[model samples]
Target: MASRARGLNEDGGFVKWDWNKNKYIWVSKDEINKPSKPGHSKYAWKDGNKVAARRPSFKVPVKKACRQPLQVANKHGKMKTPSPKKPSRRPVHHKADFIVPGYDHGYDDGYDEVDEKENYPRNEKYNAREGKIPPPPELHSGHTTILSVMSNRLIHVNAALTFWRQGPNEYISYVIRTEDDAATVDTLPALVNCFKNKTPVSKQLSLGACFELLPTLKKLLSSKFEDYVKTSLDTLRTMLRFWWNDLIAHRNQSFSGDLQQSRSVAGIYMSAIAMTDIITKLCKRKDGIAKKAEIVGTLLAQL
Candidate 1:
């Protein structure tokens, strides 16, 4: 006798198998008398030495497509995970307060107040009261002013010389000559004395005397003397030298004093000397003697 195999079903029921028939049998202890359904038959099986008459096959029924068991997923309840936080925004800064008014777009509330003071007027009262506008102290003619006085002196000398040349018998002529000679002679001495004594002849006297005497001497000597007219030329040269020295002294003083007149005086002195030299040369010839006085007189007038 062969032993039979047995297994438990899903419901914890026992399933028995017969080796000879190769079939499974189900036995219900609670209801053993239930009839098998159609297409299934009862069967006899021997186990050990005992025989069982009626037994049902243990095959389960084929399930319909709609009746099949559904697959159920076991899902854990949803966990609450926190969302990541966003980073904070930085605060915006405004520009500083000390910015200039026109440039700044923000508030100007805290600035200091500025005080604007009006300017005072300048004091012109003293200037106005003094009438500080006298005719620019007459700008004395540099050459003319000096020459005028010299001219007057020479006139006086010439008158006296004229008088000395004419005799008393020719009373009218004498008077005229005496008057001219006195005038001309008088000027030369006065000028010489002024220079010798270091006394300054007024600019008028200095220039005038030179101008008047130069032509007169030239004229008088031209008739009798050639280029080397010693007596008259000596006198004229002496006078000119003295005048030149005086002018140089005046120029030095002016320079020390920082005066503008010194420049003019110096220029005049140079011009006069040049003119004198020209005249002397011009009248040096024998033919030139006749016109020497007239030419010299014309030159003086021009000066």
Candidate 2:
């Protein structure tokens, strides 16, 4: 060990067995900021370390960092890139006495089956009450959702009354003139309401509403607007179905015991007769209405 140390510390061409150790001490050129002749006893590797000698060129600026040499003696060492700190995991908490409303397991109330009418407009009241807006209309066929909560709330034949009261034929005229897809969809909820009943009033009004629709209906058959034509045809077909269903409802009620008390049989009979005449008149024309006479006849037969 002493010989090895001497050989490293010496700076002579020939080995000196006992040349003064102090005078012959070797200073490493790689040593940074090192003296010209540092002694072997005051060695840079005093602790058996091979630290790179710091030179004038190796003076790191105050702003810069000097990286330490790796310690090879230790089997495991800190890596340049640290092992990722273990994630600061969220601590789990036990459930307290407070109940989470929707989190309740297997609760099956009427909320699961809310039959939201597809074309029903988003009423502000309903939105507040329900806590959600209905999706916008899927089609631009001039049909829109009901404009009012009252319109939305109307059920059975009342929706059909709203349809007529709003003047559907005139609404159709405006929609056709404007040629707006949104306007076309706007008319649908009312037209749709025309078929939303099995009542006597709905049946009678369904026929008149078809007649009211005839102007817009005829224009649609020959007009260039495909979506308008489709909406008109569908509306006409649906009204006929409503008429037939109302007739059937009337038929069930015609000879019933309550007919004597309310005495609405004559009105129902007149509505059926008038529907047949108007439909037969429509059959005389070369329009699509005449083409659908078979369905009309079937509807009349059920009456």
Candidate 3:
């Protein structure tokens, strides 16, 4: 007769946690032997069959064996089969900006059954929606984006200081990683505008606002800067060709990726052209990115 009882000096069978007692309690009345080796169980399935002198368990029939079954049985209770609900699909609206990712999956746990619903996307134009540039970091939004809009044109600058000054140690690195903007002569008017009233606003940007955009650029370029520059220069040639073709496109959407994804690949090329042109003028300045590029190139060669 199997009976549940508290784990006294002799634990009958497998012990279960008793939350009320705050100690392990034996749940069965079977006579079980404890392991001799410290923290090791002799009845453990791995060496459960091994006897006092390496005697096999199969040689001695289970009917005449010492160890009894650990499993507890309830005659009244029956195992249940989970009946999964059929998932219904909604018609795809062509005007929707996003794609539906996946389907719904909900399973049963006894009487408790949950019906989890799926998510919806914005529209059918996937890249057009994805390619849309996000808002500023310092706004009421949840992001700690380093890039903040400067002037009417989009300019990426270090906005980490903006958030940190507002509160404690709060800065976002993703906004900085995606930044490609470097200071140039064309930005002089913007920088000067920022210093209006002899005191620059926290929202405005200057040469000081532009630090190492990508931290990895410094570490990785210490050894691979020259190679990266060389490869970038080669890639720049191809980008220029694509940019020219895109510029000469009769229809503005001709250079778009696909029917669904209307993302233009020429935007970065145009930004690169603007920066390269600015760096050409920055060559005259003592403190310019062109010199930094050369320094990095030289350091890469030395390393």
Candidate 4:
């Protein structure tokens, strides 16, 4: 006989062959321990084996389809994960507190972002307050102020040439000949003496005299006495250089003064500019004198 498990079958019960009655018999868990014939055998166990007859197979009922859309099975689905935003690479610039009020800091639209109403008081009472009115026309007149502070130190050609050597006999004899002759004879020597003194006031006066006489000298001797003309031009050029340097030094020194004094300083600059303008015009002439006065004229013009 074949060995088997000593328990009830998985399908609930088993069938065994009865040797005494020469037939098969059904056994349940309660009768599993009953004695059997020595050579009798139990039916082989099978997954479908059962003590009772098997029931008919049944068919399942189908249901209606859903109206909703089908979803994806994966948790990630069709949507993509967005990458994290990158940090800005540009540096932020903040306005400085110590900067001047009207100074441009290259902000938006080239202006400061200030609230005018907050910083400046504005109201009918503030507008109507006493002492808020503008000054009278007499006190604030532009033309009057300008004329009042205008310099009286006018640089006339006659006044400048007063430093030239003039004697009583020469003045009396001037009616007999041309003023050009006097200029030719005395201008160079006077210039030599003026610089030889090495005084600041005298040097300034000498520069004025030289500037006044330059055109006359150039016109008179530029064609006849080339050597004398060259010497005179060279001397004038040297004087111009020294005078220009002095002018620059004086200009560079700041002067804090009243309106009249300031206007006087401005007048000096104006005179210098006018003198340089004359030299510039002379340098533009077609004559060879232009070549001689080029360097000095250019220097003064730049200043």
What tens digits encode model 4's per-residue C-alpha lDDT throughout 221-271? Answer: 344554565555565555555566555654555343323324434444455
TM per prediction: 0.23, 0.25, 0.17, 0.27
Residue-wise C-alpha lDDT for candidate 2, range 269-300, written one tens digit per residue? 45445555545655676656556654554666
Tell how far residue 95 is off in model 4, in angstroms.
99
- How far out, in Å, is residue 262 in model 1? 6.7
- Model 2 error, position 280 (Å): 1.2
- Per-residue lDDT of candidate 1, residues 138-220 (tens digit): 66547687788679766665655554344212222322333343243333454445445555333224344344445454453
Measured with C-alpha atoms, the lDDT of residue 112 in candidate 3 is 22
Candidate 2 stretches with Cα past 4 Å from truth are 1-190, 193-237, 243-246, 256-269
lDDT value, candidate 3, whole model? 0.35
Point out the higher-scoring one by TM-score: 1 or 4. 4
- For each of the candidates, the C-alpha root-mean-square deviation to the true structure, in angstroms, is 35.5, 22.5, 33.0, 25.9
Candidate 3, residue 97: Cα displacement in angstroms equals: 86
Per-residue error for 41 in candidate 3, Å, reads 84
Evaluation by TM-score, superior candidate among 3 and 4: 4
lDDT of 3 by residue, 1-303 (tens): 778665564544567876456699766544344334633233335554444323222232335656333221222234566989877676343323322336232323332211111122334133334434334445746333333434212433334334434421122233344433232212223223333333334243221222322232223222333444333332233323323444344234445633331133334323443444333443444543456444323322321
Off by over 4 Å in 4: 1-181, 193-236, 253-268, 284-287
